[model samples]
Target: MTNNTQNGFFKLTKFEFTAIAIIMISPLLFSWSMYFQGLLIIVMLWIILGLSWNLMAGYTGQVSFGHAAFFGIGAYAAALPYFHWRISPWWGLITGPIVAVAFGYFLGKLVFKLKGPYFALGTLASGEILRIIFGEEELITNGHNGIFYMTTWTSKLPYFYIAAALAIFSILIIRKIIQSKLGFYFLSIREDQDAAEALGIDTVKYKNLSLAISAAMAGVAGAFYMIYMGFIDPEVVFALHNISIITILVGIIGGVGTIWGPAVGAIVMIFIQELFRSSLFGLGPEWLSRLHSLVFGALVVLIILYMAGGIVGDWPIIANKIKSWKNKTEGQS
Candidate 1:
């Protein structure tokens, strides 16, 4: 990594800090409706997931298509105890990441052997296999019947606060990791595994370490989802398109390999999602909501074509274009 990249790893500008402060105090500042609060909570969850995916695929150059495997397992880690022994699902907040890291460790052993698209395919299959396994293992997992429980809080306030804290925590942890030597190792691996290994770096070991951290973060998000939503099923947690693909999009659209890119991506994604889901808050026709998936896909295509570096990644280019347009308009006037 260049000196600028290393320095930029954890350094937050005033604008970014202001945004963080606004999110931290959002509930206190505005007496928002429960619906809006719910949206905020979901956005925070995605922020965590996005950051998790970014750490592995962005920093470490290991593009995983099976994040849902960690996510679903984290959720199930919490749900199983609740289903079998009537233990509080809240305990999943602790066990979720542990189990996720364990699974990631073993999975890394198998998939890390492959490189590039093959690795991606391996991960994609792992998630699907877990989904099937969980669905079939009725004796332990309750099979496809799923797990249901009444949520602890009636209001969304507590959940929002918890989610916000987790998001902040995720940001801090990732920033710290990126500033350390491990972060450099990850960058080296991403740049070229062979070169990193030639320089005496243990590529496999570091890759596993990166995956562990990523898995833990995803696991925590999944556990939080289970407790807040008060329900979980194989399909909901391990859905290939919803969890895995959306996680990838979050990384890509936010500016993969950039520290704050995922955060920006999460906000954009959730806003777009809710806007369409509500059919422009009922202003547009109901059928407009049905096109959200199509719109999202098209947006991704546009981003890849024109904004390959992502919103944050390509901010300099975007700013320059805006500046030129302003100057041209002034000259014309």
Candidate 2:
């Protein structure tokens, strides 16, 4: 079992290296143009969001349903500076993460005592509260009116490159955490907090650290989002639905606890959404919008039931099993 796990890890590492290389070189190989650049930015944003959520929910086994609160906080942090003081968003990149980490620390302190479903409910309630506050505070957040970002000389390509760099950076951070001692601590805590504590692991500290890191990454993504869209509203940034959808779908479709799982899940979900929006629009039915959600929801359910290990996890297992079978057959022959 140890050997098999090690081999699996090696194979996954190689595959990740290759995939990242391909992604880095994609723009040079294919002309993405300007219009496609925006799409890439969106994909990269989702990748960052998915990866950050995976770090918290996947590895730590702390299912936070309210990550969108940090995301919204980051977006507002960036936008508020630019709108009020005419400051560059570059500064917000630093401030956003700081604010998010602080908020995450508070959240961890508040809810780490709770276990399982209670923790999830706490996060969900916190998210709802943030949404309500943002929506009601018209004087600060502009309420339902939203805030328009000031235009800059930076074009869509810069934003695309920025998003791509952030995605890569996030993946690298996750990969490092997974391979480090901290990862083992997180895994131990996930399996059994009491056992981990008995083994001398500081479960609370590690959990808070993981939460802070995850929130900071999400904040960075949200900060960039404000710059990319040049506008943000409480409805768009602080929406609980967005939080639930991204966290649930990414972790479910991708192999939770694996570095590349959430990223792969984000890519698949985004492509599916785009395909549905493009191809299903004129299918001669007014009810087609419902079909998209229905199909996606069904797919999520099936993935959860059959592929609990996630696409990333199961794909390698199946591939290795086939290979082993083939080798055995050849030996018999």
Candidate 3:
């Protein structure tokens, strides 16, 4: 866990380098099983979303409840190109972020005027509005029937590698940004906007900047989703409960304000989701499949009650508690 910063923004750490290596080569051990590969790709997608959301909400303190706006826009940006006339969906990796940032800037102009929970609610409303609009725009979006792509590959291996690359790239970029001076400005604004303003930090400008960057990465994830999954509907991409709220929970459960928190959170959330969805590999009852959402709610409640700062944030407390219990048992023995 050693880090060396070169000129503030170009530093590398052993942990980061090791993580990349493990992610790149670990699938070989499983012999690239299609199921595991597909599952890993989904995990990478969520990692991207979690990391993107963490940038603004976790680091910059502008929590958004409507990130689905960017994700759905990205998906459509990639899909529409192919669906309308005849263009490669690959181009979406470029246009998706652009459109998302455009809308994100527009939304930022309005919502950044509000603060705290008001800002969160404003984002929630904005996401819902976009979801409705996309759902109704049959001519342009193909409505509830959704958009589908032929897909670039039959096997999940290629998609898994691509997703892993994306996840790595995004993590590096965000890490650089957070370690730079801009990262400090974001923190100052988050800690106290009025104080940051008093210090001449231009909190409004920085908040918008954070939003734009966050939106871009999220849009990229959305576009990636469209490509990987091959089909998407308004409900699937822009759903409040699934996309938006899950992102917030990822940050919260992972450990807000920490660079690695959302990553951990995304992994845990997705694993738990798959656990319930698969019904413990057919050992559990089929009815349990329907209880994933309920399990998520329960997990969140438990985390908040006992680990207010999330697993990573509260790791010391948890470790100490475990140690104390172990010592007591040893003494009794």
State the C-alpha lDDT per candidate. 0.92, 0.80, 0.87
After superposition, candidate 1 runs with Cα above 4 Å error = 1-13, 28-30
Q: Give the per-residue lDDT digits (tens) of candidate 2, residues 73-163.
A: 8888898877778888767688988998999899899989999999999988887888889889888777888878765645676676778
Off-target runs (Cα >4 Å) in candidate 3 are 1-11
Tell me the tens digit of each residue's lDDT in model 3 across 45-142. 88888888989988889989999999999999999989998787788899999999999999999999998899999999999999999999899999
lDDT at residue 211 of model 3 (Cα atoms): 92
Better of 1 and 3 by TM-score: 1
Looking at model 3, the pairs that clash are none
Which of candidates 1 and 2 reaches a greater TM-score? 1
**Which predicted model would earn the best TM-score?**
1
State every prediction's TM-score relative to the real structure.
0.95, 0.88, 0.94
Please, what are the lDDT tens digits per residue for candidate 1 over residues 228-288?
9999999999999999999999889999998888998999888887789889989999998
RMSD of 2: 4.3
- Residue 69, model 1: Cα distance from true site in angstroms: 0.3
RMSD of each: 2.2, 4.3, 2.0
Task: Give the range where candidate 3 is weakest over 10 consecutive residues by summed lDDT.
Answer: 1-10
